[model samples]
Target: MSSKCIVYGYMFLNVKMSSLLKRALFNNSQSIRKTAALFCNATRNHWNYQYQPGPYPKTPEERAAAAKKYGMTVEEYTPYPEDMGYGDYPKLPDIGEDSKDPHYPYDNPELKRNFNEPLHATAEIFGGDRCDISIRRRFSLLHQWTWFLGTLGGFALLMVFLEDYKIGRPVTAKQIPGQGVHYLFSPN
Candidate 1:
């Protein structure tokens, strides 16, 4: 009897543990699979593109010829300066020069603005209606034509409805025109 009870308890525990494991897997299956695939693709790209460097040039002459082909001079072969062309501008004065130099006027705020004032900002600020004569004339003609066509259409519809018979009114059993075939052929 004791052996029988032990076997039954073992079976019960096994069933309960398996059901809990299955429920957890059902909830997290998609996320686990997606993370695995992303890791594999990232590993593949790293191995394919970034790991390998090309064969090296074996001789000094070959290296120098390749450098000159790409416009690097012999002086630039070593560790290059970060500010290679920082002071190439013609207008910038030498760093240790005196402020009395003529080119130093560009560095002064009042002198720079007075010498090179922008054109548009100095003119009067006009509101939205301000425009050239040609634009105003074109828009005036366009507005007149649009108003005339809209009024003509409204008058034509009013005259049609004023007729003794409502030609274009929605049809009802009493208001429908007499039954007659208008045409038997296609409209075109």
Candidate 2:
């Protein structure tokens, strides 16, 4: 080809062949799978779009619409991170009284305030919020220390147990440290 097209300022290809490479690869205007819209959909404020909330509610009507959409009163409604850009906010479904609904274990203000108690059975293994609670009873600083030190100590203990063998060693047991000579003051 004579010229190369750079789509969305990312694709800078030196095209020399004539194939589907001409119509498909250069721009998001034509292709079905690799579209330019997906790559160009960067949020104004956040890097990761899936993890962040919408950038709506710039006005009172927007807030009322959002509150109504979530089936909550305007006073009771809480927006996540409040106004960044237009996001398809997840609809808040009613989880009922027992808190067994599928939506209950997801991130929400109520779950943050309420889920202080340890999760059990299915709840412990299933949801991100449930496992993330990680109360002091189930997880602790001591646990973290034990996890780290246990691995190091266990490896060291294995090495200490194995280093005494004469299979591949050049020294005798009497020449080994602590076997015959004292470490504090040992004269050869």
Candidate 3:
């Protein structure tokens, strides 16, 4: 085959391989992957897991064993709370922090944080403050009516303007002297 044809064939094979790789990576069906998994744990975060939930073994007999199995103990492990929904779970601790958020440098005040300075750092400062629009509406009653009437009036005027022009065959006909008289409409 020509050099061009050989290059085209290679390109086609590469495309096919890439597509197959993509299908294997991002396929909707997870049964094959789940079955293929040798072991499922919180660390791997597979769809099917058979992990022992906690009150974390933060200080296990072998801390390394806990670290290897659970990953950072309370620091990073996301317990399988699926059993909690079914009311068959252990008394899990108040779990919230995932350690993913950037640590605030308390020591260095000069360095501005890359994150936006939150409106309320510790608590919802504006939680108690409420504005009830029903009691006192933002727009006055007069203003509301004026706005509604203006839009409606403008629409009505445009409709009347459309009615001003009449487009159809003329009701009366002009006569050609040589030809017979013509009527645009037959007598009723």
lDDT of 2 by residue, 70-155 (tens): 45678876564434333424333333223444454545544332432322223434354434333325567788899999999999
Candidate 1 weakest ten by summed lDDT: 88-97
Error of 1 at 133 (Å): 71
lDDT of 2: 0.52
Taking the tens digit of each residue's C-alpha lDDT, what string does model 1 give over 31-87?
Answer: 767867988765656345422222233466644553454344544433212244311
Per-residue error for 30 in candidate 3, Å, reads 21
Checking candidate 1 for backbone clashes, the offending pairs are: none
Q: Model 2 residue 93 lDDT?
A: 33
Error of 2 at 124 (Å): 18
Angstrom error of the Cα, residue 155, model 2: value is 3.9
Q: Output the TM-score of candidate 3.
A: 0.21
For each candidate, the alpha-carbon lDDT, in order, equals 0.47, 0.52, 0.49
State in Å the error of residue 163, model 1: 99
Q: Using TM-score as the measure, which candidate wins?
A: 2
Name the runs in model 1 displaced over 4 angstroms. 1-31, 39-41, 44-56, 65-71, 78-188
How many residue pairs clash per model?
0, 2, 0
> How does each model score on TM-score?
0.17, 0.31, 0.21
